[model samples]
Target: MNIYFNCMKGIVYKELIRFIKQKSRFFSALVRPLLWLFIFSVGFKTALGLAITPPYETYITYETYIVPGLVGMVLLFNGMQSSLTMIFDREMGSMKILLSSYINRNYLLFCKMFATSIVSTIQAITFLLIAKWYGVDISFLAIVITIPVIIISSIILNAFALFLSSVIKQLENFATVMNFVIFPMFFLSSALYPLWKIKDSSILLFEISSYNPFTYIVEAIRFSLYLKFDIQVFLILGISLVITLIMAFVGFKSKKVNHG
Candidate 1:
């Protein structure tokens, strides 16, 4: 048991060290979400009149409305970024070494997920602090409540990335998957606006948003930020995590067989 714990600790430490060593990567991870919150949200605040959501007694600025989405964006991108790093590691032969360790593969993967999720969640909280400095009203408790949700969301996203890595077989293919998968997931979800806002324009788009996992993630964060719980968010996130983990497991298994 002690040996297992030490292996997990080593995995987490390696991830943190790698992330810190790559200063450029850390800055890049931070930049996109900041742009959305500061530039885009500021410009759209007047143009987009967001209605009062629950826990908000009166109408709020568009910037406030999309803050949760920006947090979600941070997690979403970071999760994918973790996947990209994994691919890079595999190409550099580091992943093979890690996998060749006597430690359990599933536990090793979980440690990877946990480490990446911690980084992503930290970025989200940092983004929130910056937003608060910009005059966004957020309770201390809300910030506390958001931690687990961000962690879960990050894990789900990382699992998806792992699944993608298993299928693509090359680091070069990651960019293509990001373009095809991440962008659409971000834009189509209620991350930028509420589902009711979309309903005003087209029922189909609204319905699509309702079904998207990203939508639930945004909603989950939005609710948590208000110090509330959304059961549906828990349900969707739980199910997505299960499915993505299964896919990742299958992918890892295939990789093992091929290498063997």
Candidate 2:
């Protein structure tokens, strides 16, 4: 138990240190979402007004409607970025040494996921604070409640990214793969627009977004931000978290064996 605790502590501290040193990562993560919030929302507000969404009791401005989605964007991008770092570490042989250290591999991976999740969650909370300051309808209590949700969401995203990292071998190739995965996932999902709107526009896209795990993640955070919960959203998030973690573990083990 002590060994596991200490290992987790070391990994988390190392991730935090890295995050602090790479100031660009912190700012970039915030900037991407802020751009969507500050620019895209205004541009789309008149053209794509929102009705009373489930989490929202009354009609909301496009800005409010999209805040949760932007939050998910932060998690999604940060998760993929973490995966890119893993690829680099793997290429540099540091990951090999760590895995070979023989601390239970799954536990070690969990520590990495947890560490990255922490960093992602920190960035997310900071974004939420900035959103609040920018006059979004976020309550202090809601932000407090959102902490756990963001942590869970971040872990799922990080696990998914870790699975990708385990499969993708080269850092140079990761950018192409990230683009292939990230843009489609973001644009197709409910991140930029609500499902009903998508349904109105294209049934195919609506169905796709319906099945998207990222959509559920965004909805979960959306409901939580409004001091609400959906059993359906929670169920999807739970399933996704389990499946992604399993895939990530299998991915790492397979790659490690192949390397060995």
Candidate 3:
């Protein structure tokens, strides 16, 4: 147990140090999400209208309604972006040292995931604070409730990144996968709008969004932000975490095989 804990501790420390050393990358990860919250949301506040949804008492501005989505978006992209960097480390041979270290590989990976998720969660909280300053209705209790959901969502996203890094042979190819997978997943989900709104435009989109894990994440945050609970979000997040961790394990095993 001590060995296992040490491994996890080392991995987490490595990830945190790496991120901290690269101040530019850390700031960039933070800036994009802030831009979405401050500039884009503010500009579109009037353009998008909101109908009454559960957890909301009356019609709200689009900016207010989409805060949870924005938080999810930050966690989602940062988690994936961290994975992309991991892939680069592998290709550049830096990850070899990590693999060869005394720590268990699985524990190391978990530590990495945990560290990245923590960072992503911190950014999400920052976004929430900014939203609050902008007059978004968030209570102290709601913010407290949202923390676990953000952590779980970050884990799911990081797991996806780890899986991708394991399978894809080249860094360039990772970008292709992101374009095909990530963007579509984000825009198609209820992140920007509610499910009912999507259904109004197209039933097919609504159905697809219903299945998207990101939809559940957004909904989970949306409900938590209102001091409510969403069972669907919990189920989707749980299943996604399981699947992602399985994939990450597979990737780690494959790497061990190739290296051995």
- Candidates 2 and 3, the one with greater TM-score: 2
Please give the distance, in angstroms, between residue 131's alpha carbon in candidate 2 and its true position after superposition: 0.6
Per-residue lDDT of candidate 3, residues 127-170 (tens digit): 88878988888987788888998898898889888888888887
Cα TM-score of candidate 1: 0.94
TM-score of each: 0.94, 0.97, 0.91
Candidate 2 backbone clash number: 0
Residues 134-252, model 1: lDDT tens digits: 88889777898789988998888888888787788777788899999999899889899878889999999888888889888888888889887778777998998898888887788
Top lDDT hit: 2
Q: Is candidate 1 or candidate 3 better by TM-score?
A: 1
Write down the RMSD of candidate 1 (Cα, Å). Answer: 1.7
Give the true-structure RMSD of model 2: 1.4
In order of lDDT, best first, we have 2, 1, 3
For 1-260, candidate 2 gives per-residue lDDT tens digits of 99889999999999999999999999999999999999988889989967787888998888888899999999999999989888888888888788888588889999999999999999999999999998999999999998899989999999999999987866788889877988878888888888888999899989988998999999999999999989999999999999999998999988743335
